[model samples]
Target: MKAITIKQPWATLIALGEKQFETRSWQTKHRGPIAIHAGKSTDKDACNDSWIKSTLAEHGIKSYKELPTGVVLATAELVDCYKVETTVGHVSVLSNVKVVEGLEVAFGDYTEGRYAWELTNVQVLAKPLEAKGQLSLWEWNGDSK
Candidate 1:
């Protein structure tokens, strides 16, 4: 499947459902199964931040110990994509994704970055694997890149 690499902490946030908006500088016209590849990089300070710690605690994230300096934690599929309604304008959300492989994820978003991935399947490639958090169309047939 095609993938888009993401930085650390942010990647973990997606896998854990902490920060929902997968902020991208551009918007995608392609819609289909996209892979959530956690990049092999980590922000130590982010891992220890009070907000993240508290959020993980609430979510019962037990793998924090394994989040090393650089590693891909998990992988997921964006099964569905949509434009969410809001006060400002519609934003994207990948809805109803299955955490097929990695840790259990459950978070929400209300920003323009990104809300959810319509996850159809997931593969926990590694708790701290050497990969990148990337998202991209699995066999993009669309004209937009």
Candidate 2:
């Protein structure tokens, strides 16, 4: 399966169903089922945020140390990729969106020119399979059955 390596907390947040979009500085044309790989690096600063911390706590994750890394955490459909047009005040209005605010905005960087990969039908693995991460989209050799 095709996989994308994402830094921790963000990867876990996506797997936990709290985050719906994965923002990137780049964009892709591929649209299909994609594996969500949690990279070895964790964004400690992000993990320390009160909102992120509380959200992880809600999922029984006590701290950043407890987040899984070097594993494929979940699978989701790469439904859409929208370019962030510009920010109207604090909220971003996607080129394809009229206005986007709230948690969706909080979960990602809505800076103009970035891309938001819309993920849906997320299926988190009960036992995450170990896998080394790579930059951008790469192929995962593991059986996702």
Candidate 3:
């Protein structure tokens, strides 16, 4: 399967279905099954936000260190890629959807020119599969890198 590496706790958010659209600097043409890999790098600053910290805590992740890394957390379909048309304060205008407010706003970079990769049908792995992650989309051959 194909996969993309994302920094925690974004990866964890996606895996847990707390966030639906993965924002990117560019658009993609590929649309199919994609694995969600939690990269080894954690955004400690993002994790420190009160709301983010609380959300993670609700999921039983009390510390940023407890978030899984270097592993495939879930498999999801790359359903659609939308260009972020504009934003006013908190709402991000995508091709056919709008991210209104709250965590959807807080969890992503809603800059006007970014692409939002819509993920659906998330299937979290029973246990995380240990694997090294690569930049952009990559092949997951069921082994550690």
- Top of the candidates by lDDT: 2
* Tens-digit lDDT track of model 1 for 7-103: 6556667666555345443456545444455556656666676666666677666455654434444455554444333322232323332221112
Q: How much lDDT does each candidate structure score? A: 0.47, 0.89, 0.88
Give the TM-score of each candidate: 0.48, 0.93, 0.93
Off by over 4 Å in 3: 97-100, 143-145
lDDT of 2 at 141: 78
Error of 3 at 128 (Å): 0.5
For model 2, the stretches where C-alpha displacement exceeds 4 angstroms are: 143-145
Q: In model 3, what are the clashing residue pairs, if there are any?
A: none
Model 2: residue 98 alpha-carbon error in angstroms: 5.3
Clashes of each: 23, 0, 0
Taking the tens digit of each residue's C-alpha lDDT, what string does model 2 give over 1-145?
Answer: 8999999899999999998889999999989999999999999999998888999999999989999889999999998888999876558887666567777788788899998898999999989999988998999977633
In model 1, how large is the Cα lDDT of residue 42?
57
Off by over 4 Å in 1: 59-65, 68-129, 132-145
Write down the lDDT that model 1 would get.
0.47
Instruction: Write down the TM-score for model 3.
Output: 0.93
